[model samples]
Target: MELTPRLAGMVALLAFLPVVAFGVFRTWWAGAITLVNVVIIAVSLYLLMSPTESEAHAAHGDDVESAGDEAL
Candidate 1:
């Protein structure tokens, strides 16, 4: 099944909800959920930190001076 970004984020959060609930209720699943959440958060952060190809190109081009003066 094709998953949209919103759906994926929801699924990620939902996956931890049970554990959070269990932890709040003082059940054995507290640590398990915390660990899972940590892993998911780490992965999310990694994805966010990674740059796209266009961003890299723009960064490289940004320092190039314009040639408008040559047209005069």
Candidate 2:
């Protein structure tokens, strides 16, 4: 399965729900933790949005042939 930004966001948000619920039922600072978790999830999702340079290059078929040619 290919991991994508939307998938990562969905997964992280799902994982965070329990923590948010627990925090709500616990202390105030515990509730504050929900915000921190959200920020982390957002950043992770943002990063996942783009494939790295090598990954992008590999996705295109041309690079693989060029690489093989160079090895000869």
Candidate 3:
């Protein structure tokens, strides 16, 4: 099975959430910062790993609908 960009982001977020929660429960402001950092990282990874419009179209060949879905 292929590991998509969305899944990569999800996995990163899952690991980061616990760290953020730990910091928050400890009453540290660092938790909020960690949350933001994690979000940024996840977004970066997703965008970087995801297929471009042209790439998606090329990969799918005649399947325009699938390419459009991937673009979303």
Candidate 4:
């Protein structure tokens, strides 16, 4: 399955909304669960939004391969 960046970000924010509301309402247990949910959402958002190291490596791998070829 695929999600657009904007949709993913919005989902992340929505996932945290209940926690924020629970905290404001002083519902401790619900707030705690919400906080956990928020953390999970945050990590998911970061992972989704950030570029993977593999992509960088792939981009630079050609240069490294060319250098090795020159040395041969």
TM-score of 1: 0.38
TM-score of each model, paired residue for residue:
0.38, 0.53, 0.64, 0.55
Q: Is candidate 2 or 3 superior in lDDT?
A: 3
Determine which window of 10 residues in candidate 3 has minimal summed lDDT: 56-65
Task: Looking at model 1, report the run of 10 residues with the lowest lDDT sum.
Answer: 62-71
RMSD of each: 7.4, 4.5, 6.7, 4.5
CA lDDT for candidate 2? 0.74
lDDT of candidate 1 over 1-72, digit per residue (tens): 756555555556665665666667786666676857766875695566566776776666544353343235
Between the candidate structures 3 and 4, which one is better when assessed by TM-score? 3
| Clash counts for all predictions | 0, 0, 0, 0
Off by over 4 Å in 2: 53-72
**Candidate topping lDDT:** 3
Residues 1-72, model 3: lDDT tens digits: 788998898887896768667786875777767777888988999999998988866766776677577678
**Worst ten in a row by lDDT for model 4:** 62-71
In order, what lDDT does every prediction score? 0.62, 0.74, 0.80, 0.73
Off by over 4 Å in 4: 1-18, 64-72
Pick the winner on TM-score between candidates 1 and 3.
3
